[model samples]
Target: MNKEISIQLSNVSKTFRTSSKSFSTLRDRLINFYKKNEVKTIKALKEINLEIHAGETIGVIGRNGSGKSTLTKIMSGTFIPDRGGQVIKNGTSLLLNLGVGFSHELTARENIYVNGSTLGLRISEIDELFYEILEFSELEDFKDTKIKYFSSGMIQRLSFSIAIFAKADIIFLDEVFAVGDNKFRKKATEALKQNWLKNRTSIIVSHSTGVIKEHCDRTILLHKGELIFFGETEKALAMYEELE
Candidate 1:
């Protein structure tokens, strides 16, 4: 427990119990369930020991399915670790997956208020930021259109815009995969640099080595749910390349 640590994981291990039956049939489940129901525990995090300090941009990078999202969930308090524990010392909002809250029937404008407030914005705050979100999303013309008419890229762009509107001590972003076009992606990236990078504890999980090299001060490498390296960005990236 370092004094400056905003997030800490000490020997933290997270496991999930899954059943073989898939809840299909009682007979099949009972027949095959003689072996104690065949419950399998999947370890999503293994003996993770790390610390995140204030005003640090840390990148959590690894291949797909390397438990990056799981780790984000734990930090967001959406999932509790099974064995050893984790602690978050600041307010954290995770934009790990996009489109988790937008209703298809609702207009993009409506979703802004609903979704933005869900991220902890006050109604007045959302009202003040509505135009900004629409502007940043590049969806002004589509503001009245239902989200069902929006493309995946548009949805992500909108979600990203909304996620950063409300102030938080810490934020976790899971890749910039669906930010419309390259131009829009660059816009979002610059917004992140100009806005989120200042006076915030941010964790970004990205596959882009260039992004890690360019932005992160510290990097952590994960392989098959196990933490392999935690140190300076360059050193951890070297480990990532060797593992790859």
Candidate 2:
């Protein structure tokens, strides 16, 4: 049977240009005002091609500065690839990384409405699920609290709750397990197994080999800003361990 392609990337790449000159003080800034700072290019992702099937759980693993986050951002439409690169998505996608996409100055309740609306939920729908989102996040006490005051765990839980309840078609989990406590991590893991994996396309980026081995059917191994391997979970883990 042929599976539907949820995401397709063709010649996708990202590069960042940075200036070498730094101005530490007003005098330094004035001195460099007319001078052109030498610009350097860093290729965060080399031209990479991939096709992810709908309802598949893909894992991305790599050491620091290995372009893992960059790749996910591109896939989730947070970052645009250079010219001649292409990314095609079959459905609405959401990137769940480190409590991003939330306004910290707003109350948790307000952010929930905003986020839920972004996920295509009507205001009435968000109103209905508002309490459930708070309850699931174990953040009932902080519903009215400003998000800036919430702990990382609290923010992560709230973010995850909103994504799950919002039913995003493609979810990119970027090191999300790194923030929450053990108890909440367990709950989140279980929720992923029960809810997200059943019918959605998911890309999980984690440092834990156990997580990739347990949850991913296939994994992509990235090294030094390049995708070196994309295949069986065990094989990718073996290559990652060798790099480590």
Candidate 3:
């Protein structure tokens, strides 16, 4: 039997508008007020079509500025595609990237409550999972410390631990293995292999071909804001290697 379609994107594209004008002072700002702002439109993603199947682990590889992150955001509903685009998602999704869903002003303890609540857990449930989250993140000592003081690896570890316990149906992991120390990376990889990704649909966005090759059955290669290749993991990696 065919696998269920977990996500489908048709004619999906994203464009960003940026201003080129720079104001160095109040007078500079005022001088440019009457002039039309020089706006540049950059296509972050072109018309892309893709179908991701349920329970499949997919890898996305690309060079910088290749729209890998944009594609994941669109799938996770964090970014809306341009007009005439459609996104069909079949499950509750969570997007995991470095410090994306965290509040720098809040302590780790406070963030647990906030993030857990956002994930549909009640106060009591959060209380129950609170210790577990901290333990898994190996951040029990810094629970009351403010997030801004934490290192990037600490933040990513905390973010990932929460997602695992919350049991999100679809997970978009963006460069998860990049920031942390080797020990944590090994631990996280083991957890994914042993428990986390079982029967779950996940999209891993990473520059590491080894991670992609080991985890993903299929992979997609993006270049210059376009979906250039999608097929077997080895084939996609080969194409990405040539591009690099």
Candidate 4:
């Protein structure tokens, strides 16, 4: 696994500050002093150490708010670690959470260009993958429509479509295969298979053990910010299932 490390994290930790009260009104920010409860910080991750080699498909699984997305952001270098060091060797594309990197005012087609560019893909590259992305999303009917009018599933379908075709060296996905109808999911499955078969590295965040069991050769577990397990998929999955 350490043959050629694409990413490395050493004792990384991230903490977020929390306010005592939700600031709903301007007056709250203006005069909220003693009315606020004790301010505390949440440790999203602590002492996380991991090494990702090229051509590895690793599955990241944990319950909701188990610091999964936080870890992904940390790994992608979008969110800086407060206490440790990380090195990433290649360009990485990520789908961190729902509703990221899309413009509400733009048409789906325009946003496709925008999102693709944000992922560092050239217009020519996107063009080559354009029809394929559309075909995968099954949203050709809504391609010219504004994204504000798109349903959640539609947004996810298009986002996933663009992400897969962006052509970064490393791909990161969150809760994939949950968008679109069965047909699109089936198509996406094939695309993912092809990507892995080609030796492109990927880290997939999913709730379904089946995704890990079927696609990933390795599994990494994080519980409340610690690296609890890292090993073969079946053994890690077995330990995770026992946590319930």
Please list the C-alpha lDDT of all candidates, in the order they appear: 0.81, 0.89, 0.87, 0.79
Clashing pairs in 3: none
**Tens-digit per-residue lDDT, 1-244, candidate 3:** 2489999999999999887656546786797888766778999999999999998899999999999999999999989999999999998988878677789999999998998888767899888888988998999999999999999889988987777766577888898867468888787778766554667898999999999998998899999999999889999999999986
TM-score, prediction 1: 0.90
- Give the least accurate 10-residue stretch of model 2, judged by summed lDDT: 19-28
- Candidate 4's TM-score reads 0.88
What is candidate 1's lDDT per residue for 79-160, written digit by digit as tens?
8877547555565555546667789899998999888877788999888888889999888899999999988888988988
What's the residue-level lDDT of 65 in candidate 3? 93
Q: 70 in model 2: Cα distance from truth in Å?
A: 0.4
What TM-score does structure 3 among the candidates reach? Answer: 0.91
TM-scores of all predicted structures:
0.90, 0.92, 0.91, 0.88
Winner on lDDT (1 vs 3): 3
Candidate 4 residue-wise lDDT, 96-153, digit = tens: 3555789899998898899988878899988887888887888888889999999888
lDDT of 2 by residue, 21-130 (tens): 56556787788889766788999999999999999999999999999999999999989999999999999888887688899999999999999899878999998999
Clashes per candidate (backbone, < 3 Å): 0, 0, 0, 0
Model 3, residue 195: displacement in angstroms? 4.1
Sort all candidates by lDDT, best to worst: 2, 3, 1, 4
Which candidate should be chosen as best, given TM-score against the real structure?
Answer: 2
Candidate number with the higher TM-score (1 or 4): 1
